[model samples]
Target: MTQPTIVFSPLQAGVPAAGGALEVLVRVQAPDRPTDLATAHLPKRLALVVDRSGSMNGQPLQEALRCVTHIASHLTSQDALALVVYDDKVDTLLPLQPMRSTDAVAKAVAGVEAGGMTNLHGGWLAGAQQLEGGTEQTVSRVILLSDGQANHGETDLSAIEAQCREWLGRGVSTTTVGLGRGFNEDLMIGMARAGGGQNYYGETAADLYDSFDEELALLQAMYLRQVGLKLLPAAGVIVEMISPAQQLADGSWRMTDLAWGAEAWVAVRLHLSPGMAGQTRDLLAASVSGTALDGTQLQAHAPVLQLPVLDAAAMQALPRNETAYTRLEELAFAKASEHLRQLAKEGDRQATQQALDVLEKRFGHHPWLSAKIKQLRQLADEDSEMMAKEVRYSMMRMSRRLVSKEEMAYEGDETHVSESVMPSFMRKKVSEGKGKKREV
Candidate 1:
C-alpha cells in the first residue's frame, strides 16, 4: 500500500528563475476515512492523573469522577489504564492493568476524596511512569485533569514541560484538561505542546463528559507515529521552518506524530540569492519518515520544488495558487492572534486593536476565524489570567483537532463562568439568562 503523502504547497507554485525568497507549506496526511480500531490492533496505554486538591472537594471532584466513568466505558481489554490522584501527595489508585469493568473503575474513582495542596508535577510524573517504555505500536497518553494551582512539589512550568518532552521521545504523550478557572492554563498548554498531546478546557460537568468522549475518539483513531521530515536544499539555498519542528545538528528537522483524521502541516520559508534568468534549478528535496499502524516503517519524498528563472514580468504573470496563499494567511492569523493576546494583557489597547484590524482585513471572510475574533473581543476586558487562558485555547484548538465538546457546546448553551473572577458585565449576563429558553 502507498504510504501517506507529504505535499508541498508553495506560496507561488511556480517560482521565478531569478529567485529571491519562497514560502512553502508542507502537509502530511493519510487517506482520509473513518478508522476502524478493532482491526487496527493498536493497544492503548492510558494514565488518568486527577487533581484532588481541597478546592475540588465538592462539584468539581464529583464531576471529575463521573468523567472517569465515562472514559472507562469506552476502554477495552486491549487497553491498559492507570489512575493517579494527587493532593499534597501522589497516590496511584489503580496500577497499570487491562481494562476490566466500568463499574469497578468508577467505584474506585468515587472513593477518592479531595484534600491538601496540589502536587501537580508529582501526579503527572507518576502517571507517566505507568506508561513508560511503551512501544510504537501502543498509543500511550497521560491525561491530566487539574482544577487548582500547583502548590507543592516541582511547580515550575518549564521544568515540567521539559520532563514531558523527554518522555515524548519514548513514545508517551501527555494531554491536559483544565477544569474550572483555578488551574494555571499556561502550564497546562505548555505541557501539552511539549509532550505532543492535545489540551482541553472544561467549564462544567457536561463539558467534562463531552471532553472525555472527544478524547476517546482521537485515541481510537490514532495511526501515525514518530513522524519526521528531512529536507535537502539544493546548493546555495537556505531553508527555515516556523512550525513545531526540531532542527538537528546536520540541518534536518524532526516532527512528531501525525494522525489519520487530523493532518499535520509545517510552514517553511526558503531563502534564495539572485540567480541567472532563463534557467531552471532544483530548490529543495524533501522526504518524510514514520512508522505505520501495522509496524511497517514508511517513507515518502515529496516532489522536488524547482525554481524557474524568469524575468520579473514573466514571474508576475505566472498564476499563483489561491489555496496555497490562503494557507499562508491562516498561519499569519494564528500568529497575530497570539500577539494580540499579549498586547491585550499588557493593556496596549491601540496595538491590540491594530492586530485585530489586521486579522479582520486578512481573514474576516473565514467564518471560523471571524467567530474566533468575536470571542477574542469579549475577552478584551478580562484580567490577564482569563485573557491568557482564552487566547491560548482559542489559537491552539483552531490548528489542531476539535477541542473537547465542552468548549464548542451548542450555541446558547450555558457557559460556566467563574463568579469570583468574571467581570461584572459577564456575571450579570449569566445571571440574567439563567432560566431562559433559547435555541442552541
Candidate 2:
C-alpha cells in the first residue's frame, strides 16, 4: 500500500503559555506514485440518472443525450453502466452491463424523449438501486443529472439527502450535475455533500462534457473513497472543523475522497484552556480513515502534536508556519466570496464593494490571493448568479480538498484549466484550448 501522509501543523510553531484558541492546519495527502495507478484503478460501475422533463424538451435534452453517449463511448470493457431517465415517472432505460459495446445503450438513449414533471428523487433512487451490493474492488457511483426542480415525487430535500448518505454507507456514492441554472443547486449540492461525492454544474453540451471528463479523471486516479477525518483535542481543547464537512452517523467529519497523489485536508480551529507556564504539551490527535480501492479499510493516525508552552517574549520570537497561515487565508477568502455572493444577489452593490475591499486589504498582499479577490470583484459586477453558483460549489470543494491557487481560479473560470490547473494524469484527457469551447 502507498500509505498516505497526514500531518498536523499549528499556525504558530509553539503554543503560548496562556492558551485560548489555537488553529491547526491538517493535511492528508495521497501519495503520487506511477506504479500505484495500475493497482488503484480497478473496474468501475456507474449509473446515469438523467432528468428528461418537459423543461428539457429541446437543447437541454439534446445536450444530455450527447453527454450520455459521449460517456458510454469512452467506457472500457471492464466497466459497467446503467441508465435511468425520469420525468413524472421513472424508467430504467438500460440495466447494468459491461461496456464491450455501446450499441445497446445507444439504442436505449435514442428511445429517450422529454417527458412530464421532474421526479428527481425517484430517478436518483432508481439509479442507486441498480448498484446494490457493490464490492470493494469496483467503484460504484450514480451521476444524477437534472435541469429543474423536483416537484412530482419525494421532493423532501432532507429525506433525499439522507438517502444519499445511506447509499454512501452501502458502498455506492452519488455525484450530481445540475444541467442549467434552473436546477436546484442546493438539492444537488446537498446530496453530493452527504453522499460523499462531487457536485458540478454546466450550461452547455461542451461544459457538461468537461465536467464529466474531470470526474472520470478523478475516479480513474482515486486511491480511496468515503474518506473521513477526526480530531481528538487534548484536555481543555475544543476543536471545530473550519472547512466544510458532513457529520457522519459515527460523528466524524466526512470529506471528499482521495485521488492518488492528490490531497484532502481540513482546517480546524482549536480552543484551548490556559496551560501552566514553562511546560510542553500535546495539543491534539487526528486520524484519516477510508475504504481502499479493493474494499480494504485503511487509516493513518498523525503523531502526537507537541508544542512547548512559552512566555510572552519567547512566544513572540517563535517562527510561524507561513504556508499554514495561507490555508487560513484561503478559508477566509472562500467565506468572503460566499458573503459577496449573497450581497450581490440582494443588489447591494455598495456592501459588495465594501466586502471586496475588506478581502483585498487582508488577502491582497499575496499575488495569488489578490488575483482571486479581483476576479470575484469583477464577477460580482458582471454576473452575480453565475458567481453565486461558483462560490457555493467552490466552498463545497474547498472544504474537502487541498486545492492550489490554480485550481481555485479554474473553478471560477474553466478557460484556463487545460493549461493551468489539471495534473499530469488529466492533461491528455483535456487537450489544449479545449476550455475556449466551454461557455463557463
Candidate 3:
C-alpha cells in the first residue's frame, strides 16, 4: 500500500489554449486510521480548563464537571491529564499527572463548585502552565469550557489571541468551548484559530456532551494536526488562496489539519499564461510539511499538476469539476455568513437583506445552499446574532476539518472516528455516537 501523502487536484480538466487563469483545489489525504500499530500516535496531554464564574452556577457548572469527567475517563495510561477552574481567582482541581487512574481525579472533580467572576485568561494560562513540561513527543491541548465573557482580567481579544499563538509555538494548543449565549463567540473562535485548535460551542449545558465527544473523536482520528504547504507556481502565475491560512516565516501557508480517512482542502485561483494546445505542462509544484500520526516529522512533495492547453472556446466548454465547485461554494457560504453577521451587527437590515439576495443569486443552483440562504434570511429577520454565532461556529469547523455533507447537515457526527488508539475506558464515548464494539 502507498503511504498516505499530499495530492493536488485541479478543477479544470486542462488549461485553455489561450489560458489566462484557472482554479484548483489542493487535497491532503490520510490513507487509514491508525490501526494495530502501537506507536502510531503521540502521547496526548490534555488540560481541562473550566470557567466557574457566576454564570455557570447551576446546570452549566454541573455539566461542565461532567464534560471534564467524560474527557478524563478515556485517556490511555501513556497520556496525561490536568484540571483547572477559575472565576476571579484560579484553582487547580487536579495537578498534571499521567493517566494511571481516574480515582484521584474523580475525587478532585466531586467537590468543585461555581465561584465569582470570569477570569477567562487566568484559567487558560493556568491550564497551559500545567502542561508546561510538554515536549515534541506529546500532543498537549487545553480544552477550556467557559460560559461568560472575560470580565475579570486581560479582556483584550487581540492580546489573548496573541498569547494563544505564542503557546502554540511552545507545543501547547487551546481548544475552547463556549456554553450558552453569554460567552463571547468572537473571543472563543478567535482564540482557537490562533492557538491552532478547533473551536466548538453549544447553546445549552447539555450540548457540552456532544462537543466533548466530537472533540475526543477527532483527537483519536487526528493524523496531522498542523500542515503547511509551499506552492511553487509556474513562472508568472499569480495565485490567490481562498482558505483562511496563516503564512509562516518560511513562506509556506499553514492549512487545516488532516484527519484519518478524510481529506483536507484549500481552493485557489491561479492566473496563467497561454500555452500550446498539443503539449501538457506542469503548472504547479507543491511540497508539504507536518508531523505524522506517530509524531515523526514529515516532508514530501505532491505530484505536479500537468495541464493540457486548449483554445478559449474549448476551455470554456469544459465541464466544471463537481468536487471543486462544491468546495468553492462551501467557502463562499462561510464567507457570506460572516458578512451577513457583520452587517446585522451594524444594524443595517437592508444591507443584510441585500447580502442574502446576492448570496441566493450566486448559489441558487445548489438546493442545500438555497436552504442555508433561507435559514440565514430567517435568522437575519429574527435573531441575527444567534444565526451569526451558529454559522460562525460551523465556519470554524469547516476551516479546521474536512466536513462532509452528512456532517454538515447533522452538525456533530463522529461515526467515522476511530477508537483504535484510545484506551479501554475512554473508548466508550467513541461508541456512544455510533455504537460499535471495539477491541478494548
Measured over all alpha carbons after superposition, the RMSD of each candidate to the real structure, in angstroms, is: 7.5, 3.9, 5.1
Superposed Cα RMSD, model 1? 7.5
Candidate 2 lDDT, 1-440, residue by residue in tens: 76777878789877777876777888787876566365554688999999999999988988888778878877899899999999999999998888888898888988889989999999999999999987888889999989999999899999998899899989899999888667888899889988877877777667767667667767777888888887788887888888777667777888778877677777888887778777888889888888888778888898878888888788889787775777677677777677777886777877888988987888787555665567667767876666566666655544455443223422233334442345432222111112223323
Q: What C-alpha lDDT values do all the predictions have?
A: 0.71, 0.76, 0.73
Q: Lowest-lDDT window of 10 residues in candidate 3?
A: 425-434
Candidates by TM-score, descending order: 2, 3, 1
TM-score (C-alpha) between model 2 and the true structure: 0.89
> Which segments of model 2 are wrong by more than 4 Å?
34-41, 347-354, 366-369, 402-440
Candidate 1, superposed: residue stretches over 4 Å from native: 32-41, 248-251, 343-358, 381-387, 399-440
TM-score of each: 0.83, 0.89, 0.84
As for candidate 3, its clashing pairs are: 16-310, 17-310, 17-311, 74-426
Model 1 residue 297 distance off true place after TM-score fit, in angstroms: 2.9
Instruction: Please give the distance, in angstroms, between residue 318's alpha carbon in candidate 1 and its true position after superposition.
Output: 3.1
Candidate 3 lDDT at 92 equals 92
Candidate 1: lDDT over CA atoms?
Answer: 0.71
Number of colliding residue pairs in each model: 3, 0, 4
Give the alpha carbon lDDT tens digit for every residue of 1-440 in model 3.
Answer: 22446666577788876767787888766666545643455578999899999889988888778778777787878889999999999999888988888887789878888889999999999999899867766688999989799999899999999999899877788999887667898999888988888776765545555556666666766667578888888875778888887788898887766666666667788888777887887788888777765567777788778877887787788888877777777677777678777887776878989988998998878655666667667777887666667667656544445643122332222333454433221221211112222223
Off by over 4 Å in 3: 1-3, 38-42, 100-103, 135-137, 343-358, 371-382, 403-440
C-alpha lDDT (0 to 100) for residue 411 of candidate 3: 26
